[model samples]
Target: MIHKQVVNHRQIAWLVGSLLMTGMMISFLRSVVQVARMDAWFSQILPIFYALFIAYVLSGLVEAYPGKNIFEILFIIGGKWIGGAINLLILFYIWIILAIDIKGAADFLHISLLPTTPLEVILLVFVLLMMYYGKTSLEVAARVNEFYFPLYFIMCISLYFLLVNEYNVERLEPILTSSLDRIVVSNFLPVGVYGDIFLIGAFLHAIVEPRLFFAAMKHGVIIVGFGTTIMLLVLLGVMGFMIASRLNFPIYILVQQIHVTDFLDRVEMILFSVWFPAFTIKVIVAYLAFLVGVGTFGGQRHYNTFNAPCGWFIVVSSIFGFPNVAHIDQFISYSLPLIVLVFQLPLAIFLLIHVRRKNKGREQSLIPEGTKLYRFYRSMVWITTVCLSGCVIVILIGDFFKDKSAVGGIATAIVFIALLLIALLTSYGEMQALNHGKQKLGRAKQAGSFRQ
Candidate 1:
């Protein structure tokens, strides 16, 4: 059995924020422009639901599994073969996420802040830090997260002071406008950004008291979501829709725009400083998730040995993941949400249902065949599938409705469709493969026992 260790409540909370919120805000600021255009601030109002929903699902998992981390729960519900498959996919996901973060940080610094430094140098430095932290236990990472989270928050809140002249409440209005569909679509930005919260489930084993896990998880998730929404709203208010949507690094740009005085013109540098701690937290979270994944499936007794190799692998994969920065932006804006919703939520739901079934001493459950709760969950499965299907349809329709003669518009649409299809196919294939492996294992075990 893996040993349990203590992490402070404050660190756990920051762990959630740094993992999902910090670097995400950079991407979120850039992507929100796709739907809301000049009304990006207005679109953000919808994510309160998305953020809360994600937290609720994660918290539910903690309640269902109690002391188990994500990998242990996967093993229990899916069985070893299937569970291992799912676990590996999660590992792949974390690795890819880390790559994106690395590339993004490198690109931002190279173009916006540091032109002389090579991309490789930036990436290597970041990965080195992540590797160092990854070697430590989850408890240490959590404490570090706790320490840095406040500094990151201070940097974000400092925006209000620096950009007071830029704030225009009127930029928030011309509200709603029969654009409910657009508003929901806009949710893709923050949803993709915030989906990293699921990684926190990997740390559940570190908490000794099973009952306290869910409460702590819920508290962390809700607080992080609340903080992100407020920060995004404040950013919109300070930058206005015009500038915020156009820039690749809206938050960074807003900080650069800060001119409290002539000498203070370079206050934007402080953002870079604060971003290090935030990024550090994010890297550690991804590293931990990847470590859990490898340890589950690769027969490794310890996770430290794989950290260096995994870091290098992530760097190489990230460079090839996107043909260019534009493609990365398009993927995040147009396709990432469907992947998160379909792949993540279903896994969590299956785990929760499986645990609940096992705890009730039934292979299935004792719920009446057509009980309300059963029916509701059944409906939810179908609804989720149908809603995701509709998202695909709507995206296609939007592409068809666009002016085809415009070369740039057509190119963007093609890239968008291709990326979405790739993500969907990959997620579906992994989930199916994992489930199938579990079923086969159960049958094999039964047959072996019969022969005996």
Candidate 2:
């Protein structure tokens, strides 16, 4: 229940653009290159479909329920218990993402900028800054993004130009030569990377011009997509996939190669300084999402009360989340993509279905009085219940048979079952409420007739 603040479309665009672009300049390039090889640049094209679909769905949601963010819409569609459960789940996901970014950024700084400094101190300072940003209103954060993104963008462009002399056109040869399985799998990588587009839903209510929401998101996604693709191509052409993939931070290595003259040797430091604001914006936005979700679920009007405690928790978790850089790389390369899809895609599709029903007026008409439609709706509900039960049973049996350590898999299965049960309960509650309201109206109408 955070107070809504109006932000212009340009500010929203800048914030999102900075968030997407920040990850591109970090360890993400190496992950993409690992799967797509020299054609990793081409893989950037694959996420456009995901971005467009998500944008379209979010825009429709905003248009249908003006001035209500996704969390409020979820409450209307699913009721308090179910919607709060989903919000908690999304909040957990955002927390994990923020922690991972904090850890990664701190690791980068420790390795390159402050080799002698304690990692704990670095993480503490970074998380404190993010907490400060989180405490501020969304409008303030949006204004900060508007101010810094242009400087960051210009630095990126200049970095590309500085590396032009190092590009080798021959390195990009033999495109599409990777196995079809590998290439198709490679596409999912970027889809996960770009999944942050869905986060824009949380901020939709604060946007000043609802009609321009989709346009702003589209422009930001396009800029990030093309910027990443071009940067990957340059990295591959200049350093080749072999050298680029081996480096912990390929973009840093690429920047290190830029030597304009005798005096301009260590320009990588300058690039590093320019990129920090973009990275900070990413963490701040994620933290903002966590604050908003928590507040919305707890029925609080403001989230500033929880910011410090959550920030401290994130700082501790990030410091211990991964023992070292290799663990971070492994999670990014394997676990991250699946986690992103599991949490993001199903929730989005569910909301899309609900929004469609709402827009069509089918939501209220589903249980029409004394009609076949009511019976049909009941039948569909029964079928859905049966299917969900079967899914739970199948998942339990599969985990028991296939997993050596069934704890994680079983936990996941339980969560899915809980989600289904919540949805069913919410629908029942809504039906009961609707029927009670209709009966009240009938009684009032009878009283009016008697008075006449």
Candidate 3:
């Protein structure tokens, strides 16, 4: 058996910070702008709720499986064929995420930072940095997170202070009047943005304790959610929702409104400095996930060999994914539900169920015990499932048939998501039962060995 390396607590904390903030920076706010127009900030409630539910369920699944990463769990649940199929889906999802990260970074820089810099050069630097870091182990990634988070947090706080003068409460005054339907229908932006938290399951085996899974995730979500809500509020208040939605970098636009006297007119640069590192961490995380998925799915060998090819694929695919930024914007707005259903939800439910079933047979005979923290995690699946189900229900109700002009199609979408969430939860509940039994047996075996 291959020895599994463990990441330390500090690094794990950083990893969580990097992942959470990365979600905030990449597509969440921008996607919201594309949908609800001036009302995008307010419209985010539905998607935020949905994304949180998905995050909880995804974390719960990782908790239930103990030492298995998502790929191994897939195989256990569906056998080779079905599991392979699910893996393939995950592979594609990772690919898309990497592509988006690359493109978003390059695009943001080109539009805002170094306007004349070649896009290839910008993307190449990022890809190389990620490739170097990706090979360094999860410990390295986490270490970087811990090292940089202080500076990152400080810069973020300073940014808020710099821009505080620009806020306008009148802009957010008419929060709910945009035809409740329109406000609801526009929430796909945040949903698409935050739902990527599901990808963290790829690292379940790499973390110290699976029980800490939800703890880390819940903390991250609250941070991102609350931070985002505040940022959006600031954006709406400062720039007015109409103007805020019109700017490509809503944050940048807000930064420009800063007036801490004429001396600090270029505060946007400071914001970019803070924002750039956060963005780098996002790309790094995506690249790391891609490398791991390749290694895990390719029979657990040659991770380094796969890095260059995967990086190149991210480069090429990003260039080809959309004709231009407009298309990317449109896709983020309308195609989100399809992406969530086909990729995030199905895979999560499948893996959770698969693990539970396999755990059932192990109830009779067990081997050396794993971590105690991991066992506590396997027990929490039912509680998580119930909470997640309720959250999903709220999202569906809030967002369902939100397109008043296109009520029929919207209702269909709502019903479909509801059905998917239910199926996933029921399937996962069964798997949790099996996983719990396996843990019990394993404990028994350990106890007998101790007596001997």
TM-score for all predictions? Answer: 0.74, 0.77, 0.74
Better of 1 and 3 by lDDT: 1
Clashes of each: 0, 0, 3
* Model 2, C-alpha of 385: deviation from truth (Å): 39
Tens-digit per-residue lDDT, 186-219, candidate 1: 6666676677777777776665433233334434
| Candidate 2 clash pair list | none
RMSD of 2: 14.9
RMSD to the native, candidate 3?
A: 8.6
Residue ranges of candidate 2 with Cα displaced over 4 Å: 361-452
User: Which 10 consecutive residues of model 3 have the lowest summed lDDT?
Assistant: 364-373
Q: Please list all clashing residue pairs in model 1, or write none if there are none.
A: none
lDDT of 3 at 186: 66
lDDT of each: 0.61, 0.70, 0.60
Q: What would you estimate as the lDDT of candidate 1?
A: 0.61
TM-score of 1: 0.74
Worst 10 residues of 2 by lDDT: 362-371
Question: Which residue segments of model 1 deviate by more than 4 Å?
Answer: 1-4, 42-67, 359-452
Cα TM-score of candidate 2: 0.77
